[model samples]
Target: MESSMKKPAPDQHDFHFWTDEKFRIADTDLNGHINNNAVGQFYEAGRGEIISSVLGPPAKRSIGAALARVQIDYLAEAHYPGMARIGSRIARLGTSSITIAQAIFVEGRCIGMAESVIVFLDKATRKPTPMPDAVRDGFTLLG
Candidate 1:
């Protein structure tokens, strides 16, 4: 029997944060396709940009955010020597946590999608801390 799962499609307008990245030769595996780890890095790049835009640069902040969980679905294989557009948006927000939805597209094809949960925490205590009003408001604007 064939699986009933459906693959995700590329929809850039559905996300608020957008960026484009080029795949390097090193990003490919021996099979000449982009490696899963490279795809993960693309997702990380999107998450980092969103977090920085909302919460300020990590170097200047005493508090920091950490990834609580990340789930990625690989929809299609991607080759190197190409560019990809990555989109990220806030899926949910809590007092000290936020869930981000991300998609990677190459030539208008959805190659991967990911959902990540990040928790804001105090650097010193390493425990969850309420997000600042400014940061929360910034995230709200993106949604």
Candidate 2:
């Protein structure tokens, strides 16, 4: 089955935050290219950096963030023995959620892109809650 959650691909210039991840030899598959799962992990790493940058460390924040949904589109093949340059930015920010748009590049060429929806949760109740003003303000700068 195909997913209909596609969004526009982002260029490197559109990113507000950048993360470079080394490709592990183990990330390769029988086809000798980085596997689809590795591409998803690249997005995860980018999102982690975004969260850390916008929300600070876990102990410093009143609320926790959780991944609600992610849609990845693979556009090209990436081989091992190189770095994956992942770029991330806030595509949308809501009262309790933020949507991150990201892309992965190898050798300056875009290989994949993803959109991740993250929701803020109350640490005590573990339920979605409104984000604090400070947190919202921080993310706004990345948009």
Candidate 3:
């Protein structure tokens, strides 16, 4: 699929939360490039980090969060034996969900960009739940 990120390239300064990921040899495909699945994992790690930092750990929260949807655009191929810098930021917030904007950079170049939606759920019923005031306020600071 084509992504609008093709032109003007993504800038790291647009993101607030950053996660450092190592591109392992095992993450490479037969073509000697890092696979798409591996790139997704990097995005997951970045999302987890930003969530934990903003809302605290999962074990202590009354509400849980789950990834509802994700759209990633492969802008360039990434190779192994390199470091991936994943950048994440809250793009939009809803009553029960948050939309995250992300970009993956390898060797200082943007390789991919993604947007993910995460829904808040009640821990007991597992149904969609409204975000707490404190939680909303916390994430607002980051955005």
Per-residue alpha-carbon lDDT of model 3 for 22-72, expressed as tens digits?
989889999999999999999999999999997788898778999999999
Indicate which candidate wins on TM-score.
3
lDDT, candidate 2, residue 99? 98
Stretches of model 2 off by over 4 angstroms after superposition = 1-8
Instruction: Supply the global lDDT for candidate 1.
Output: 0.89
User: Can you give the TM-score per candidate against the true fold?
Assistant: 0.92, 0.92, 0.93
True-vs-predicted CA distance for residue 117, candidate 3, Å: 0.2
Ranking by lDDT: 3, 2, 1
- For candidate 2, the TM-score is 0.92
Q: Compose the digit string of candidate 1's lDDT tens values, residues 8-111.
A: 56587788689788999999999999999999999999999988887778899757899999999998899979998999999898999999999998998888
The weakest ten consecutive residues by lDDT in model 1 span 2-11
How far residue 59's Cα lies from its native spot in candidate 3, in Å, is: 1.3
Please name the candidate that would achieve the greatest lDDT relative to the true structure: 3
Model 2 has how many clashing residue pairs? 0
Candidates 1 and 3 compared: the better one by TM-score is 3
| lDDT for residue 112 in candidate 1, whole number 0-100 | 85
